[model samples]
Target: MSTSIATSHTATPHKGLPPGPKGTWIGGNLSQIGPRRVDFFLMLAQTYGPIASFRAGRWRLFLVSDPELIQQVLVTDARSYIKHFGARTFKPVLGNGLVTSEGDFWLTQRRLLQPAFLKTQVLSYAPVMAELTEAMLAKWVPGTSVDIAFEFSALTSAIALKTLFGLDDHGDRVRVDESLRLTFELLTHRLDSLFQVPLVFPTPANLRLKRAIADVNAVIDGFIAQKQAAPPGNDLLSTMIAAQREDGTQMTAQQLRDEAMTLYLAGHETTALTLTWSWYLLSQHPDVEQKLVAEWQRVLGGRAARASDLSALTYTAAVINEAMRLYPPVYVIGREATTDLELGGYRVKKGYTILMSQWVNHRDPKYFPEPERFLPERWLDGLASRLPKFAYYPFGGGQRLCIGVHFALMEAAIVLATVGQQFKFTLAPDAVIDIMPQITMPPKYGMPATLTRR
Candidate 1:
């Protein structure tokens, strides 16, 4: 049975703005979207049609859920759009990195960095990924309770440190991890708050954010200086350090820092959340866990998963796909229009921000029957090929698609299989798991579970 959702980009006859929930005179829909943005965006799509309009402060925003509209915004008319103000909020930390830069500069940097993340290049890191994961498992003992979220975060962070910087020193990894946590938490706070405080104001929060950023920059700078002094290795930092532009000019120190920070943060955080959520879902669905382990046993047979083995681990990949379907790490992505446009028969003026949410689109019943159920088997067939392009985008779409898509998938699969073969988690009775939609969605209270040796 084909589960693909039929969608069309043929615009309806020009109408006024799409319907949406009304908001107060001063704040618009900012208050309504407080904290629970993922749920709020889903509600907007459910209550209104695909293209829903609202206001946040001075910004006119549209929550576009229809697959065709999403395609138009992300791919067809992508040139007419750029990342929204929300993404720019992290520029303090990300600098002019790929995630924060735009236009020609972003294109150049992307081109310079693209070859480093090629599938063939990424596959070489498989051994490092599995080794780091095995090292993590070596520390775990059955019947020991752990904060599963933190455990995975640490493991992925370590893997990222090794792959990105060629740093195996435990001390450097801890420093980077702590500073990143503080910086992101502060940045997320700034993003969620309606009122803005200038970073130069020396306010308590601004001061804290500044210090956190400084700490992260200092660590990155140290790594760069070390990389510059040493012989070039195969790590991402070394690649970026040696990357040159078309004019034969190498990336300046600042550019290297920006790109390194962007890759470092982007590389680990999302994959960690993927593993975290995968474990949570598998814990809740034992039958699915059993099947996943069975596949691993038949294929891996007491060995760590390799990049070549990824193709044969059908059930393992399905579990990851299903996990992402239910709880996408980057649940929502927004773009601001560069010119006036029409979408879903509504006029979208210049400067309007459009949000395309995976949380909403991934749950659309047209594409996913019984959308809330954790069903990995749904992806075992040719469902991905059958689905419309933007209907199930987890990493996103368009020219600006995540460069680390293959790397993240490979790391997630290797880590999932290696860890799953050794142990399974049982959620603690008192554990409270809820989504906290920050830059990436993580459990609000953290996932507490007991490790049960498989």
Candidate 2:
């Protein structure tokens, strides 16, 4: 659980920097950190040891792979940091939502939205999660080839729509889906680009991004309007709509849209990736899949999964935990230092950005033996409890830990149990599994698989 790097590779007192790969005078590590950034971070950690420093353009970024160092950035010194610039790129799409907001406003929003994601509240949505999974499974035909990633994405999106806004209309779901896809794709492009043009500029990409944001905003606005016209409901949006601050002020209209969009994106995308990667891993390891199926058969006996059945599905949870360890949905989380500080014996300037990569930490050979292999059995022996908290953080950590952690885990388990009871997937002959590290790490090439009844 305690991963120690070579003391020799640790930060040295040379220009107050940690040991890292040297780069060009102008671009620094930016040019070298091409498309597959997850791999780049992994290389940084492996090559330079746990705490590595590099520059991306003008950004003084440190890749902190040490679990103790990660803990300091995410928990102990969390208040000294804010979300890095990469997160801010999606503000046009996310608005001032929880994911991007900072300081007192972020705290207030977190407190207001906390009730809806509480364990008891999240459990109330388990039936809906199972129902939606069943609906998806109802359409699956044995011997048919499908993109498993797309299937799970659509399924989780539907669950998000229904659970967040109480709207199950297919048209609205498709509209929001398309708009968000376009919006995220555009924002990702901007995030990768070296020179970002202001949104005010009428560049073609900016114009397209603007339209995409407006399209999604239109869908969200309509949902809000409908929710306002009707009686209050149990959905998250309704909760947000009714929530008032200690000063008796309610969230403004824009605030509602931002928070709703944040919840919708966070609620679905990561869970979708979790399930997607889980199926992919299950496809590769039949022995593991068989063990998972046996557990599901013993627990549910061909019935749909319920919230109460979660604790009984030990192997199922292990499979998810292991899959996330290998391909974490939110691969890397970055925090910008708000003031000059010392980390791992190196002076972190006010604007320095610290990146803790789950992609790197989760695979630490010290924590997980045979880290590259998909071994769900490793977690069956209470490994999670033994590992350093930040070493296996798929849901993140600290005060800003994902509010929907319980909800996502429950949904993943239920959906996995509900679907695994009936069908198992086999990867297509020519399927090329690769990581596409955007806001989340989804398969670069879609997961092509044929379904078969278990």
Candidate 3:
């Protein structure tokens, strides 16, 4: 779970820094942070100002809402920090994939994975997006409520798998869906305190996690070993397998397995969350929905959307950005300082944690007025131009920004555009959505929505 591979951290403290929430006897604000971590931080931002601190157990958690300090930590002095432990803890699940790992290895993996999703290359995958959306919509029954969140999770799962590994079997759809859903659910809870004990009795959660991981790993291992032996198409996975260093060293099978898991998880989860929230936002704002449909109708005219059409779907793109702003899939970006440094004239030492929550930053009135309202027009006319780059990083910032960002945006915009042209979704009557945070933000119990053919 160590972010920096168990290396000793280098963070210094400042003199008379801002006030923080005081700790109670045992847990401090750990329990208070609650299931709603994003809301918890936003409340702290309200109570403690832009820069505040709170105790999680004995750990001092600094809550940063200032863009300047975040820019310094993530970009200008990025090398002095690394991804936080929450991301690192998934290393067993993610391997040294782009989301996890540090130093040269992370760089190498990024390079290897980059080509598969180059801008030109990603555009070629648009047809797959269109096809997959249609395929999913074909199964929906009119007037029945479906969990659109679950629907998207499954949709993106299939899209990522097919686009990367070429799993196109109709019969395996249910199997694939179950494998990913179980893995997603297990990953969040399996690493908790109760399961951390060595040789402990298996709780139902533990048992479920063990079985789920075993199933997913077996499925992935089989596909990977098969691909390695036969060597198929030039998809993302194939490109990754073929990646070599200056010394001409390619990734080992184990590395390939790890990277595949990383891509699989990364490719689907965050993208699904983005699309899910987009659907929710669109349903709420009928005006935005009208404009979005107009754009789609003019662009596609009842035909399937291509990636090249992504630029023409500006509103669609803006809506995705706005949704990410309101409900960013990766709710936070954190780093552990390796060297003592002065940021915003405040001294912070090595090993000190600096966090910038999209939950807080995207809503700061200085950058976004009435940030809670789902308004995509705020992104038009280059309205977001004035803000610092790191001020809004749902996909993260810097060279470490998501490699699959183009893919996710293209997938979400294209699929939704194509499907929305054919069907309209309204929130299933009285469905209460609780945005749940785990490795990726998702609606708890899924966002049930009724679909109607338009």
Candidate 4:
């Protein structure tokens, strides 16, 4: 692997970091980040151009809004960067899972887990995704209001656990669901807070978060104990259990727990948010919704969608893509510079935080015309192929690109096709939709919609 090491000496010692909005001496631009960092990032890109520098407390951050620079950081020169310190918040929960690890260890874990996310494996999980969505739709009564976010959260959680660990028993699944929800809520709460105390503190929020983590860990431990005794199964957890290294050794119990938790978080949260935003966008744009429904009807002939239907559901896929472009689930990607580097003509010093915002890039007018509008048709013309690689990365890019890209895409398409086939969601009268920026972006007030039977 090609890696860039941070150089204490600069080729041009006089050159400095890129320009950004000035801030307080100590706080820097952190105070400006406020509750809506996504918006602030967008504004920074608009105000200071693609590569901008700002300080948040003692931390140095460089926002790479330009697609080429983004590509440099994520794809062409990925080895020069590693997981940033901010990811430490997840370390308490994720352990040394794929998202948190770096170097040889991360590469080993990636290789071992790769087989589980291959094309054939992801395609096999589609029926479960569709079935779970169908089950969810079955519970929705016409004209009744529901929080689509919460509903999709439950649906995707079930799909994630089943696909990852072969969870089938309804009782155990419910317990996992409850625990996962509490854990995510606590995590999100912690992420949004500006002044976070250490987890060791007996603060109420920390206490609750600790309890939620323990509950989640217990659920995963149960899954591990059961899978340990059984024959190797088709699920991701089982695949990890059966995975062998160059030395023909398997992952340890702690490693298994780490991966399971990582999958549990990375697999479900973004997908649930993707579906939630898709439904919300569809509700707001009737023409898009009509086109989506028409595609489902034309493709499925009033039956449920299948993995086989994914290819035929082009418009359905486009709608989901467009929804993600508007409100990407993981809005920002962060990496730390391992060595000194020049990115987009700016001299990036070693140890600087590199921030790339999909929220900003996906909405840039240069790459996406009518950037603010929900226009799925734009995607139908192969725009993704023509535009820059990093322009529309809802699933990210390069080696560290989301391991579950195929799985998430197929799941989104199947869920939309199945759920859209039988029901259409209209935003509830009192619904106040806004972005809640966390590890995964979601609607702050929840997506309140009244489900109508088709």
Candidate 5:
């Protein structure tokens, strides 16, 4: 269904509430910030204090950085909003996937798929995670530099495709890469086309997106058909297929396709981004790196890291959190109001697409002392809990909280430990790092780091 557009803009002429920087009628302050979305948020925070408002393509976005304000929107009246165009724009590619769907459909799919990512189920995937890391490590030669971001991307791809879909070790790596490359292209092309026509048109970029969607859909279809023809199995595919509501109503094929596709995208994509920047942080802070390695030595002791090891690795976990504060994978969570609501003394009328940006909230100097510096020890000082839940949201908040929160954390810690115990990496000098904003934020320069066995 074509998404309903009620007001198409935050056109309300409200009287009371904090002031925001002025804007043009059509694009608002959107043009002030560069195309890099994160940079834009940072600029807005500098100009209009932590809480501000702006317009983007007819959407009235309240760009919030205050943890208290973030909590009001994400938790208090959360049901009043659902994923706005930012996320709903993904529906064409993701269908009713847990990340894209809304209403009862989203809630139901989330309930069914919830168990697959629970702590125990996630722990069950640890050995496979370890094996995959070692396999990727075997391909690496010591004292050689590699784009660690790309390597982690490929590694997570292998891990996700294997554990989630039960693909073979010698499976079609070429096909998977083709799909990933194309799907990412499609996602970005559409984002750039925000003011243009719908992307399903005959434009070159649109056609490329179409082709990429087909490439990925074909693989997903094949996987599901094979599973349907056989008996139930243990991988995420079978788990999603076999899942039933309390009333025993199983997900239909389309629903299965949606949920499976969601898992395929999320199983490792977000975690890979986290680990990629994490290694960068570790390289910049040698003391943190030394501490993490020491923790790995003391706890893992040349063995595979498990979910259980996460608690004891304070500095290591802090490094991950610190990296996320700088480079959050999901930089922003958007919402469209279903009712005329009053938020923080402001009239948030029906259809205003509010934006709660983690990129802004996390870097606010008030919450994070010297937000730019890499200080992992600050995290251990009960800093995370001292802040409100919505204050430092990397997984977001409320009903729409990321289902893969634990899954991503578990995967990251294990992979960090595995790689830390085995190798150390340093960034190549003068490497031009950039940010390519998409469904998730990723490093643009392809983080290259020289690696050697410790």
Candidate 6:
């Protein structure tokens, strides 16, 4: 049903909470959400209004689909909220990292790490991103189908490891890649299962998670120790190692591990999924693909893309932006209310969860015209300035905005420019590209596509 019709019947102005779809007594909406929680969020927004409320388990969950309300949650009144419970689950793999840490410690960590992601610092890694994409392209064979999602996963992981940790050897790549895969799988299992055993119980799944976390921690710990002994390099690890507190001390060993794990996880998966969806979208829209390829050809002239060439590759960047809008890598961003407050005209009690799904907001017809259509040209104009601030938050917004935003965008643009002109990928026959939104919205069965040399 149209949102206007649904809201007319569902809008709760005052003396009550915002309206949401019906739920059961025990599970509430939890049982109905299933694996594709994105669908449930969309249903909530469409069937209710910009502000929708529901219950998940015992907690009251609020989905803020309006851009204005999102701004309050992410920026204006951000001090009143902390990271939500769902995000805390990542603590097992990420430790007290920036992604999982909060309050004063998180602020301190952000200050220490912010310089490493400065525009100048991120630009230095452009050649590394381009070089790795070139290496990946070299391994592909024409007319053979491959799981592009897996390929991008490995490609981005290698780049993250090499540029951030200064680990370039095949063995290092393999070791880190395996550990990350296992960690992600364990997290996915925990997220998908309704009932989860405690990690201390020594269940098979718990043991596997422990092993994966150990493997990753060992790799990071070794990097820290090595960096401490050697002369510092320009890599992120070295930068962090060189940073000191007010009392002239570097981060503690555990702090180092936490930050390293956080960056490693955040840096790779989002970019990989962004490119994966870009390829899928380009495959489906040959016209847009042709436009992107034409832009690459005109901009690079058969040469590999350099960081300087990024500004000229406008259409290529738009393709990536449009793809991300349709399938945001970090689909849902959640925060918990610290005190009782009013949001979008609804009374929200203390401790209520606030959810902002880019997948829902990015597709809102109010902000983005023809929300279902892939129109990169829409971004080529002044549309960005015309839209509300939080309407297109793929990298999130406010002080907590992704520190790696510039890095991921540059990496994606460079990869597209480097690979777009040399190859064309088409979806394999009968291969369905479905989204499985776990940590990031990865393709459910992997993106099986036929790669053709251009």
| Candidate No. with top lDDT | 2
- Taking all chains together, each candidate's TM-score versus the true structure is 0.96, 0.96, 0.90, 0.93, 0.91, 0.94
Ranking by lDDT: 2, 1, 6, 4, 5, 3
lDDT of 1 by residue, 1-454 (tens): 1222234446553556778899988788888998878888888888887778898877889888888878888988899998898998889999999998999999998888888789998998999999989999998999999998889888888888888788774676678778877777788888777788999899999999899888889988987888889899988788888877889999988989999889888889999999999999998999999899889989999899999999999999999999999999999899999888877667778898999999999999989999999999999888999998988999998998899999999999999999998998999999988988777898999999999888
Q: Write the per-residue lDDT of candidate 4 for residues 1-454, one digit (tens) a residue.
A: 0111232222454387777899998778877898789889888888887777888777899988877778878887799999886776677778899999998999999988888789998888887887777777778899998999988887887888788888764566567667766666677666555567888889998888888778778888887888878888888888888888899888988999999889887888888899999988888899988888888878898887888988888998889889999999999999999998877666778899999988988888877778899999998988878987887898889888899999889888888888888888888887889987767787888898888888
Give, for candidate 6, the lowest lDDT window spanning 10 residues. 1-10
Worst 10 residues of 4 by lDDT: 1-10
Clashing pairs in 3: 10-350, 11-349, 11-350, 11-351, 12-349, 12-350
TM-score of 5: 0.91
* Residue 4 accuracy (lDDT) in model 6: 30
Against the reference, the lDDT scores of all candidates come to: 0.87, 0.88, 0.76, 0.83, 0.77, 0.84
**TM accuracy, model 2:** 0.96
Root-mean-square deviation (CA) per prediction: 2.3, 2.3, 4.7, 3.9, 5.1, 3.0
lDDT, candidate 2, 117-203, per-residue tens:
899989999999999899888999999999998899899989988887888757776788888877877888788777889989999
Return the clash pairs for model 5, or none.
none
Better of 5 and 6 by lDDT: 6
Q: How accurate locally is residue 298 in candidate 2, as Cα lDDT from 0 to 100?
A: 92
Superposed by TM-score, candidate 2 places the C-alpha of residue 114 at a distance from the truth, in angstroms, of 0.8
Error of 5 at 148 (Å): 1.0
Between candidates 3 and 5, name the one with more favorable TM-score.
Answer: 5
